[model samples]
Target chain A: MKFKAFLTENGVILLEKRFLPALDKMGKICHLFLTREHAFFLHNLLSGDGVQSIAQFHKEALFDDYRISSQNEDRIAFAIDISLLNRAVRSSVSICSELGGGGSTANRLQIKLVKKLPPNSTLPTPFLTFETKGYKSAVIQDVPISKPLSRTQVLELQTALDMAQDLPQTLVQVPDLNQLQNFVDRMKHVGDLLNVSISKYGDLHVQTSTTLITLGAEFRKLLVIGEQAFAPPEDQTFSAQTRSERAILRGDAQSVQVNVKHFSKSLQCHLAKPDCAFYGIAPQGACLTVIFQFFIPGTRQTDKSISLHCRLPVLDPS
Target chain B: MSSSAVDAEAPDLVCQLDNVQGMVDALSSVRWKRNQDAVIELSEHGIVFIVEETGCLQAKVYLQRELFTQYEFRAHGRPRFGVSLGLFVDCLNSFSVPGHSSFIEIRYPGPDMKLLLKSVDSLDSCIYAEVRTRIPDSISWDYNFEPAGSTPLTFTVKSAALKEAVDDLEWPGSNIQIKLQPAPPAVTFRGEGHGDLQIDLMYYVNTDLLVAFHCDRQVSYRYKYKFLRATTSNIPNSVIKDNRGSKLSIGRGGMLKVQHLVSVARSSTPHPHIDSAGYQQSSRIAYIEFFVKPEEDEDAVND
Candidate 1:
């Protein structure tokens, strides 16, 4: 696969010309120059497909807002469009790696602009789309999900969307209350393994306390159960036994009733695939793990043993 | 077991048997006499009599008061069986309170035997009033015994005055029975001067809250009972000959004293099975002193 990197007004614009290793072996090359006029031509040429063309698709123009100058030597145009670049391919491309990065190691530069190419156009000769064509995939529909998106692609796509923007938008759309409620309910069913093992994707908006998660679905599929997990020995005084602890997702079954025992407790969430919203990593997973540091009241310590368990459905479609 | 033989010479002995028979017969009849005497005086008010006759027909009467404390009883008798006595004291117009009377009902197993005493309003019927105006000090008694040939003999009796209050009974004037029910133990006399006296008797009664038994032991000493603190002091018996190992020695100060016997002492004061925080309070305050067999070495006074 071929990538073009060049300096522009804003800083640098790196374009992934071809994304398949096999296509790179076949000598596929991308030749879009880093220039504004070339970006405009590319935008107009493929503007009429089901694909979204973001480079010259002016939002500010319709909103009567000022236009900013393109940062790169060329308006770095990009698209999920494999058809248009068919003419550029020398041979069929086979896809391998799963992650996408800003720039290669030799070229440690940040991308400052982005555009989408139109769909269904033939691959330009000397450039090729990977025949295997598998990256992270997501399914979107008009219905507001009552549950979180349990799949990995939801987070992957949301993160990619942020990185795809020339400037990350400070205001992101949050999932509705019904969606969060459903997600929370569904979270009770996922097993402990899935609850702590899966990855999560989150987005932060400028003006809200709610962290909008794009792929909180995996967490929604898990439930947290059991009493607070870390307690001192039975002989320790409540004051002497003071320590922060988290709840275990698997122990006893989760009861529907709110336990008076669990009042005044909180946990820090660490989702595997973090975005601006929940961008901490202690454990990696499509799952979410949290460390609940609770200042439990002294009267509650006892010889009593508590266990909790949660049921997790396998989200793998296979 | 058979009442066939008797000393024919002593007619008084025959009469004594007759009086005993009368008393037993009267008891079987369940006859209780109300105020039948107005001025008759007595000491050592002996009530419950237990009779066991074999070698010596022993008749033990539990006395509430001492031998010198006077009481007004309406009965006259020459006791028949061997007499073993108990005593109790009932005070009239105590502390000069017009209606406040204190009565001590005692049983005599020992001088330390705690009697059951109850105090109520002067208007309450169950309290028997002791008329202190008529008889203040104690009285002496002389005993005469009599035996009957076969049938029990009845003797005509007389006393100075009929006691106005019987058993210290009180009642609303409306319920007061003027006539004696079952014609109380006949106050009969052959003499003309012995007549029933009519007086505005304030009270007449008999009752108990808790029963007590007689106890007699070597620890015959003065005890001051209190609702709060009880005090005890012993008067030295200089005359008591020291019988080596026969009896224990008294404490120093010949007059050994026990003070600060509080009814509601601080829970910290020693007692068996009392937890510091778990002590319970009693409704009424009472202090009592009694000589119990010394359980601990320290409990006994060291001479």
Candidate 2:
């Protein structure tokens, strides 16, 4: 829907579009300017009347009020709202230039605005002189000019008018396919770990709101610097500080075998299931140890061993 | 814009066939509206019709099991006059925020009578649905206000188009059946192996008809959600029933537990008769496997 532009008795022009109707009949027919907002205001003023009363004037003058050429004989011009046009205007002011020429006759219209001289102020009155060189310039005179309106100012003014409104509540950044797949995998694991079924699960997910703040110095050392920068020279006790003190407890490649210990024990016992009994005794209490270890893949790393200590009662050989 | 210009700007019907294919191609890749309660809309006759949003797991199953059935059918026949409905449904179902409905509208002209393609397989049907469903999109956050520990957060949730469909469903063929398999991970280490993991997927598809013989009649079904959970920890002291890995299913309700698989260690007790070595040998490695049994066996029926 296009906005209606109207000139008020105060000579200020407003560009707006609203669903108001009866503002026309209440005042003198010759001088009254009707807009959807004015119609809405009248609807409010009349306690019992519904939108129907205002709709009557909308049928007669709403279109005429919206037309750029249509003007009421009275000096009052009612502005109907056009948000798109307003947006274009607000955006246009930023890149607008005084340089105009070398275009078709249709592109030769120019608007001249003269800044009002402030009281007792010696600051020269600024005149925005629009001239189209090599072509006859259409001159519009006596336009009350202030500083070109900023987008913020225009938006503020536009918002001040009563209208149906909705605010943007969500903005989602689209993730690449690989990222989405990874996220889906992570979400599924989370769901599985939590013992919850994620049926009807959507491929789309809200990006993780979690953020990590690391010190500049630490981040660079931990993430950017390579292992060659801290390679130990084979002789002395090699030690290096990581981004966090916890890294000290969890030793890296160079410190892998520093305080490590290992034990290999053998025991002879009886075997209850003698199906393949070739290892000698009647295996009763067989001692067995399974070792679990963790290690980084490359760069001369050693496995960290954690033994599951187990003790078995031996036969009374008395 | 002039009429011809508007028509030029007007979305091309044939090109959208490719778009529909593109949507189907990257079905799982696109994020659906997160919440189970969200509605998806389809534009027909300039009016919006909303379909229901299924929760996470249910949505995956719906896409994998149900969508493939339609995708296969549409690919073979009815390429031009394809339903192309699941794109709208899948998009709404997959990407919306949890507890929120994603309002999406897929616009199309009513039937193009001038370019009607003769149906070789069977009679084409027009299905019109006027459905209204509510989807929850608001998540309540509870926490104590401590300036030191406080994290400032800004949250936005759009109200799902309450008046329109949250999901769209269509049958592109006479018979429909869909099966899904987890896509293999891009990178796998040569020697190292990882334990059991879950992967979620989706399919955006349309079918000409579901249950071919019943195309003459309307087969209506409501989409819902259910969650499943299970415990994979090999520790014995951990809570057996509750701590076991679980699955959360979302559909008609908000979040639900679909399944639970507890580690075998939790179930087995140490027996004096059996030594540690013996018990370790007998320890049944715990891992979850899935299987589905069809109700009506066509082979059996034929036999």
Candidate 3:
């Protein structure tokens, strides 16, 4: 099997776009588990970056094509050093710039890889070809891909937010991503928990309070894309909606508590690509699924869009 | 200047400024290399906060008098006192809103008194943070480098290149041997562990790195990697001011001196109180100098 992708002059842009989201925030090292249809990069450590809070970053175009040798549908996992890759690509591209051949329209990267023997003796030597109309250069690096990373305990996601489609929900389109980022930045140190409440009238209220002071931000005229009517649990409440989802639909106000720092860090993805949609659903605990649709820069031919799924875990407010 | 001034004017030294955020950043930068408690020396030149680790490694941040908006030190002699760096930092940051500025009034009320700070945030509310200070015992910490008797070797290096080089050389050994000369092979850094790892960069060959090399005599010394490593992060995070680079100086006893202009932490506003030297004299600009003495092992190679 082979893997490859064409990228712009500076390899860093492509590197951050594809691998940064999939890998954990703090420590970029992760084990890539390949399946028949998609590849899963399982990060064993808690990333300092908000990616950990963002349960996962799911995408379809992980690799152009990653075929398995064992079977058509085989599972193989191998540990990869993301920082090393980041460093190597960074150094290599800088060399191109130092040599006076980079940052020009003629500069481009062509990567091609072939898996090594013994399932994974190590990754095969990858080919790095830097070509311009007048000059061409290449560098070959034998990256060391080792055994799968092992973990003591793994938190199995009880329920994926996307799987609960039947639950009543609402989608809010954030036209300006910077507004949310500014709020998170301001309220980052205010409290431990960031409480987000959504009202039926399409109002979004973000608040955090301490014994000393309380800070809140309100956004009005948020379009409530859609909501389905549902009944509350019989034992939950008689006069009001029975289930939490019903209350959320009726605009009784659905709120969720999450680590402020993580939520703020997770919003960093929006900085790279601002146009995003917030999908909110109220189960026993509320959850936010941010869908980021961004373009792969320098691929002027296709204008193909890449979709990234960042799921945040909502804590049950006591 | 009254010898028996009013009680309000009885402070050993009181400095007022429209902002104390600059001092806050200068204090925080040394935390990476020094101890939680630092000795602040108020002298004729300026105020120096010294952070030392086991007396072998030390970092000094010099806040010249020009940095303060209102400066006056009226004491019979230079006063050296100690306080918890953490508490002092907390006091400095108490009333600061993320990006905006705050007013600060700092005072040291004679010896054996507390370090009192008064600040007013944007809301016009006032807050106070008092940290008890102590008359430090008669422990001598020398702040002088390149003494009167000895000449020093110095060079200018691109900040980014030094950071990259340090990163490449880190973890290879417990100590790093540096060689500088007025001849060819301008700079050489060798880490002798896990197989010999040496990097030789010529002045003209690696012009992107060495930047400028100046030396009157050949100087080679072996400094403890642990001490030298502390300066690693300071390079990359150091904001390149006025397009100038970090300065490196080697003196007698193999004491490595690294001086850089560190941009004040957090605040993006341009520093105030410009100095003719082109080096900014605001809290936004800090003059940081690191001194790492060579390990005193009698058997350190050529020693």
Task: State the TM-score of the second chain for every model.
Answer: 0.17, 0.17, 0.80
For every model in order, the fraction of real contacts preserved is 0.00, 0.00, 0.00
- Per-model TM-score on C-alpha atoms: 0.13, 0.17, 0.46
Candidate 1 vs candidate 3, lDDT winner: 3
lDDT of 1 by residue, A54-156 (tens): 1221222111112224333213323222223332221111111232322333222212222223257563222211222223532111111112122342334
Which has the greatest lDDT?
Answer: 3
Query: What are the per-residue Cα lDDT tens digits for candidate 3 across B126-216?
Result: 3444467776655455646763124447777877767667767875867788888667748888888777778786898877777878765
DockQ of 3: 0.02
Candidate 2 off by > 4 Å = A1-113, A116-318, B1-34, B37-58, B61-303
Q: Each prediction's Cα RMSD?
A: 40.8, 34.7, 14.7
The DockQ assigned to candidate 1 is 0.00
Instruction: Pick out the ten consecutive residues of candidate 1 chain A with the lowest summed lDDT.
Output: A263-272
Mark the 10 consecutive residues where model 3 chain A has the least summed lDDT. Answer: A235-244
Tell me the TM-score for chain B of model 2: 0.17
Report the candidate with higher DockQ, 1 versus 3. Answer: 3
lDDT of each: 0.20, 0.20, 0.55
* Predicted candidate 3 versus true structure: per-residue lDDT over A1-318, tens digit per residue: 334444444234545554454343523666554445544444432342233322232223533323443332244445567666555556556665655764564444444344444354564532222222324555544455664323321122112222422333665555456656665675665457767665454545555555433344444346565653332334122211112234455656577877777566566666344344564544555454455555445533422333344545666644
lDDT of 2 by residue, A1-318 (tens): 122332221111111222111122222111122234332221211122111111112312222233322122111222222222233332222222233422343433232233546569777553333322232433322322234334453343333222211111111112222322322333331111111000011111111111110000010111111121332223112111121122323322111110001101111100000011111011221211111112233533432221111111122211
Ranking under lDDT, best-scoring first? 3, 2, 1
